[model samples]
Target chain A: MNESERREAMRRGPLHGPDLTLNMRSDPRFLTGARGLIASVAEKIGLSSTSCAQVALAIDEALCNVIRHGYKKRSDAPIWVMVWVLADEGVGAGLRIVIEDEAEQVDPSKIRGRDLADVRPGGLGVHIIREVMDVAEYEMRSPVGMRLTLVKYDRPSPGVEPAAVGA
Target chain B: MADQPGLNVRMEQVGQAVVVTPEGEIAYTEATQFRQWMRKAHDASPERIVVDLTGIEYMNTPGVATLVEALQSAKKNKYRLVLAGMNTNVRSVFEVARLNTVFEIVQTREDALA
Candidate 1:
């Protein structure tokens, strides 16, 4: 999908309260706008600026990873992001974002952090995804595609825990 | 082989503070320009330095290292470095680096000045 088509796809998705789903056609602009929209939703739902920022950043990195490595240019790849508020006693209640991409399987074994001494710039996407969120999980779906889920602790204020009920 | 777009930096002064805004991706290919902007901001010796990042579209580790080094240089010079206007997409790069804590982040350039 192209930029306008991606935006239209997001618009076409179901919009029930507390959950938002966006679909983008593997476009470069998705990173920029997708991240922004997610943050806005989190903020509107009372996620602190920090937590909202965290989830947005992590998701952006995930999308960037998909574009940079997941598919050949102009392929029929599609990216999906599903987000909802999850209250976890472990994470102090935060936004849970699930990012899915319909691209070739990425060998998780090939994912590695760059050496601090080696000092390069472009290899940090996966590292950032793993570091920026409370929990990062990956799994391979049958037939195709990879799913990445990230959680952010969206506490309204510092040191205060909100009530969380399981989804 | 080097036909990629160049990273761009724009600046504005907030009282004694000078805010440097970088747009587009700041990767290995563009770290030099980022560093140059940071250096220029440092040499200006403003009472405070803030990087307005709402316009920054993407950054990577090498790009991040450049910011860390900038913060260190600012500290050595006894100037407080702050980051403001972080867009969610760009902020993700910092969070992955666990760098959100290392830098003083504010919501707006006005906040940084205040």
Candidate 2:
């Protein structure tokens, strides 16, 4: 969607309370606007600027991976993103984002990004998502595609264990 | 080839280095054009190549990959690829990827030119 449409869609939301769902075409141009929307949502929910920026970047990486790996660079593909503020004992109070795509089912077990020590341009998106988010999980849908859920707590939840991948 | 519609890349020669500055978001749509521009910059075969990232507000994996590809080409061509003027947001992308060390990052174009 264009920036105006995306902004208008955001304005139509229950933005302050909780949860905003965005339906966007797979085109990468929308990402610039998408990150802004996410950061706004994150800030509105009382997240610090640093945390909000991290959320935006993490989500950016997630969506980028979806476009590259899930849709295989098809500009016309569909990407559905849902962002919400939630309170969980594990991660405390923070944001939760769910991204869904209609691409072929991907094995979550193999979703690990390459080792950072290797030092490459690609494969860092997944690593960024995992690092910024307290919890990240990928689940295969029954019929097709995959759903990725990522969460970031306000403070580091060192005691809270991360969910196993593909679980 | 026509310049990629969404991305704007400006190039100039400074001493022995070629400086390429790309403005606007470098995402999937502009990936091809960005790559092509990088190839053209390398084709100039200068002793040093500097990419000024100050104008870029947003960049994704494709953008980073394009730079990585340029780094690979720099190695094969025996030229130096230096990145300068990275805004905090764009620089974080490189840091999160642990490429802050792999790349020769400088604070300003002057440093890169030096």
Candidate 3:
């Protein structure tokens, strides 16, 4: 694929394997349900329990970011989450979680956690997602909103340490 | 949305410190209420605030952020905030986020009281 073609494909988000799609209201009440759903999907894909927990936490943070920042804590907004398993060229297998929201688009360059040295509340969600997932990308959806894709390969990527406790 | 049953926080005073024991998952839904409770405890001017996290099974970034805010409040109020009895899973979040070194984490409520 050429550069422009590859960019277009990337903008389409990850389209590999069958996926479980969940349409969630922007309410925080659905967080538990989202976690349960993600956990079940992760287990079905043969992820380790620890890995499942990690993925669940990452998805939870992402959803929270959607509600808190994207929707500005508006519970009536709509959010869609899609999950699937995929195999990379040299990374073996992994799980992909795509979250789409119709809220205002966030600048790609501004999606990051604040300095950890500050030691204060807030701004850790993005950091957690980046640290836990092997591949995380954000794309501006057509017309409006944003799409966040998070992929966690079965094995730890080079130079990236697994964030699991006792690792 | 309606209030979620995922997290329930109970506040009580143990000697000079106020102990807040949060039971169940501390996800996004519960972070707000949890932070309110922590703020209330901090505002009471207790010598210390002990957060007993023994009953927590799951916690995410928002939950951790609540604790971070509470710790900051404690510092501003000149009171100590001690977190105790974090299960491996919950404690792992702090460790992974590198916040474990920034907070006063003890093995148990007794250790926190000490």
Candidate 4:
């Protein structure tokens, strides 16, 4: 679905599960606490250890981008994060995280990661977020700023068949 | 020496090489201090520099970026750079960025020194 459609569905609470919402400044010092909280929640939701860490890392990268690129290193700017479990999907359980910022809006299409072959710093955050999360969507907020949504699906252990729906 | 609430970095000379040890999660919050420590290690003008990642259980892109910056400087300045003792999670970040091939990585601090 498109971003507006997804936003509408989220407004209607289409996904049902425990959710956590956070409102904090763009200060990097708060990253450890945020990562720990999300990692704990991911673990409780049955994601593998590696997946839990990946999810936390993805969220951390998103927050860092907001602080660095969006807010331009303004530590006091606001950032909002929402994480929820997707329990109703036919696929295995999944998690969705939404990060919102009120910084200057930019063209989402222009936010591409730099070439990895060049081997440089600073462009890897976007690449890491895309690599770790199943879904990475970006959209401009209503008045200003940007919103990013990241989703990850739980995979069954290696060599084990996924449980049949309702089984 | 560089110390922050979530991260600590210490530098020491081991023979011809300087070993820099950073303990704790190296995220965006600790990137500045980490970079500063690395810069100081470079300025010491050792023939080789080894970053011991044994104490780091977690590292984000910013931390990796700082290391990349150090690697570039090491190349330009004609000093060898080695990374050692990365935990699985920390190593995976390098693997994901396709940086595993770009760095001189070893199993332990002793290996780096050798």
Highest DockQ among the candidates is held by which one?
Answer: 4
TM-score: model 3 vs. ground truth = 0.87
- Per-candidate DockQ values are 0.21, 0.54, 0.80, 0.85
lDDT of 3 by residue, B4-89 (tens): 57777889998999999989988887888888888788867899999999999999988898898888887787889999999988
lDDT on C-alpha atoms for all candidate structures: 0.70, 0.80, 0.82, 0.85
TM-score of chain B of 2: 0.94
C-alpha RMSD of candidate 3: 4.2
Writing each residue's lDDT as its tens digit, candidate 4 over A1-167 gives: 66556444544343554378988999988888888888999899888899998999998888989998899999999999888877745446667788889999989898877888998788998888988876787889989899887877676311223664246
Ranking by lDDT: 4, 3, 2, 1
lDDT of 2 by residue, A28-132 (tens): 778877888988888887787778878988888888888878988788988888877664545445777878899878789989988888755678788888877
Q: Interface RMSD of the predictions, in order shown?
A: 5.0, 1.9, 0.9, 0.8
Q: A14-36 in candidate 1: lDDT tens per residue?
A: 34543878988777645567878
Candidate 2: list runs displaced more than 4 Å: A1-18, A88-93, A158-167, B1-6
- Comparing candidate 1 with candidate 3, which one achieves the higher DockQ? 3
lDDT of model number 1: 0.70
**Which candidate has the top score in TM-score?**
4
Off by over 4 Å in 3: A1-17, A88-93, A158-167, B1-4
Higher-ranked by TM-score: 1 or 2: 2
lDDT leader: 4
DockQ of 1: 0.21
